[model samples]
Target: MDLNLIALIMGIVEGLTEYLPISSTGHLILVGSWLGFTGETAKIFEVFIQLGSILAIAVLYRHRFYSFLTLAQFQKKGLNLLHIFLGILPAAVLGFVFYDWIKTLFSPYVVVFALLAGAILMIAAQLAKRKVTAESLDQLTYRQAFLIGLFQTLALWPGFSRAGATISGGLLLGASYKTAAEFSFLVAVPIMFGTTGFDLIKNLDVLHPQDFGVFAIGFVTAFVVAMLAVVTFLKVLNRLKLIPFAIYRILLAGVLFYYLYF
Candidate 1:
C-alpha cells in the first residue's frame, strides 16, 4: 500500500493501455480505486504519467513529426498539419468546456458502461462493410479527419477511449486499420498534452514537493513500457483488427460490473 508501489503499478497499467483502445483512464480509475488511491492528488498523478506515454508516441514517430517542420518533406510525404489540427479540435474544445464536469464522472460505474458502449461501437465499425479509401495516413482527407475528431468527443466519457472512438470512426469512414491506428496515435500526443497540462495547472495547489519522486517513477515507467507496447500493438492490429480488443473490453466490463454491483 505504499505510494511508490502504487505508482509503479499504475504506471504499468497506463503504459500498457494508453494506446491500445482499451481506455487507460478507465483502467487507472478502477485500479486507483482498488488501490485506495482515489483523490485529487491521484487524479493529478494519473494526468502527469500520461505525458510519459505521449512522449513514447512522439519518440516512435519522430520522423513523421520532424516532417512537420519542412514544407517540402511534409508535402512529399502527404502529411497535412491541418489534418492533425482538425482531428484534435472537436475533442479539445469540448473537453476544455466540460473539464470539471467530466472529472466528476470518473467513477467505476461510468467506466463500466463506457467500456461496453465503446466495445459495441468498435464491433459495429468492424462489421459494417465499408470501402477502404484511405490505406495510409497520406491518403486521409480533411473531412475524414474532422469526422474522426467528432467521434473522439465520445471519449469525454471515461472508458470510451480516445483511440477506440477515433479509430472506429476512421474505419467507418473508409480507412484501413493501420491508417486509423496511426492517425489515432498521431493526434493523441497533442490532445493528451493539452488535457494533462491543463489539469496540472488547475490543480497545482494539491501537489507537494515530496510527490515528485513518485511522479517521476510513474513517468519513466510509462515511457519505457509504452515504447514497447506501441510497437507490438501496431503489428498485432493489422492481423487481428478491432474484434479481439472489443471482446476484451466486453469481458472487462462484465467483470467490473459484477465487482461493483454484486
Candidate 2:
C-alpha cells in the first residue's frame, strides 16, 4: 500500500478516536495490521502522529494551558493546570516502566477484545447513572489526581481504550460522567505527547527522508481533524449519551472477530 494512503487512513482514525471512548489505539492496531505490520517505521509513525493529536488537544484547550504556563497572572488557572499535571503523573511513571511490553498489544484480535470490553463498561456506566466529582473545587488533591493517573495507565492496552478506562475509572471512583470525560481528556495530553515523543526519539534511525512527507501529512491531517472532533465532542457530549458509541463498538468488535477468524 502507498505510505501516504496509510498515513491518511491512520490520520482519520486518530482524529475520530482520540476523543471518543472508542479506542484510537485499537483502530490503529486494526488498520496497521491490515495495511502494514508494526515494524520500526510503522511504530514510529503511529507514535509520532499521536503527538499531532495531542497538539490538537492543547490548541483546543489553549487557554487552560496558557494560564498554567503563566501562573502568576491567574492563580485559579495555574491551579487548574497543576491538577491536570498531577493527574498525568501516575500514568507517565507506569508507561515509562512498561513501554515495550505495552507496545506489543497493538494487534487485531487484541483491539477487538478491547473495543468489546470497553463498550460493555460504557453501557453499564450509562445504565447506572452514578455520579462523582472531585470534592475540592479549588484543585484536585494529589490523591484524586493520582488515582485518575492510575486509571489512565490502564489505557496502555491498545484495546483498553484510554477514554474508556479513564472515564470508567472515574465512574468507579465515584465521579460523574461529565467530570470523568473532561478529566480523561485533560490527562490524555501528557500520555499522548510522551508516546509520540518517545517513539520519535527511539526510532530516529529508521525514519528515512521519504517517510517525513507522509508523516508530516498524517500529522497535519490528524491535527486538523482532531481539533474539529474535540470541539464537536464537547458540544454534543452534554446533550447526548454514549450508548450510540457502545453499539458502534459492539458492531466493530463483531467485524474484527469475523476478519480475524475467517
Candidate 3:
C-alpha cells in the first residue's frame, strides 16, 4: 500500500476509536500489522496522529475549558482542573516510568486479550448495581477522580482502552454514564498531549522529511473525523450505553484471535 493511503486509513482508525471504549492504540497496531506498516516509524506515526483526536475534544469542549480561566468558575462547586489532574495523575506517572516496557506490548496478540478483558469489565460494570452519586460531572468527588485515574493505568496495556477503563471506573464509583464519558473525554486532552509530545520529541531523530506529508494527512483526517464521532457518540450514549461497544469488542477479539491463532 502507498504510504499516503496507509496514513489515511490509520487516521480514520485513530479518529473513530480514540474516544470510544474500543482502544485506538489497539486498533492502530492491528491495522498497521495487516498493512505491514510496523516498526518504530509506525509507532511514532500512531502516537502522533492521536493528538488530532485530542484536539477535537479540546475544541468540542472549548467552552467548558474556557470556563477554567475564570476565578468565579473555579470557585463554584463542580468539576475543575484539579479533578482533571487527579484523573490523569496515576496513568501519567506509571506510563512515564514504564514507557519502553509498554511499547513492547503493542502487538495484536496483546490487543486481542486486552479487548476481551476490557469488554468483560465493561459488561460487568454495566450489570453491577451501583448508586449514582455523581450524575453530573459537577458531582464528582476527588476520591472518585483518583480512583478513575487508577483504572486508567490499566490502559498502559494497549487494547484495554483509556476511555473504557476510566468510564468503567466511573460507573463502578457511582457516576452516571454521561458524566463518566464526559470526564473521560475531558481528561484525555492533557494526558494524550503530554504523552504524544514526549514520544515525538524522543523519536525526532527517526523522522524523515518525506514522513511529514503522511503525518499531516493522518493528523487532519483524525481531527475532522473525531469531531463528528464525539458529537454523535454523546447524542446516543445514554440510550445505547457501553454494552453495545463491549459486544463489538468481544466480537472483534474473537475474529482477531481466530485469524492470529487458528
User: By the lDDT metric, which is better: model 2 or model 3?
Assistant: 3
lDDT of 2 by residue, 1-262 (tens): 8778889988888888887888887677777888855787887787778888888888877776676676474443323656777778878887889889877776777888788888887778677755455533233455666677787776777777888878776666666556667778778887777777787787789889888899998898899988888778767865766778888888888878888899
Candidate 1 lDDT over residue span 61-172, tens digit each: 9998887777775545465788899999999999989988998898889999999999999999999989999999999998999999999999999999999999999999
After superposition, candidate 1 runs with Cα above 4 Å error:
73-77
Which residue pairs show backbone clashes in model 3? none
Q: How well is each residue in 210-248 modelled by candidate 3, as lDDT tens digits?
A: 899999999999999999988888889899989999999
Cα TM-score per model = 0.96, 0.87, 0.96
lDDT measured at residue 85 in model 3 versus the true structure, 0 to 100: 88
C-alpha lDDT of all candidate models, in order: 0.92, 0.76, 0.91
- Clashes (backbone N, CA, C under 3 Å), per candidate, total 0, 3, 0
Please report how far candidate 2 places residue 178 from its true position, in Å: 3.8
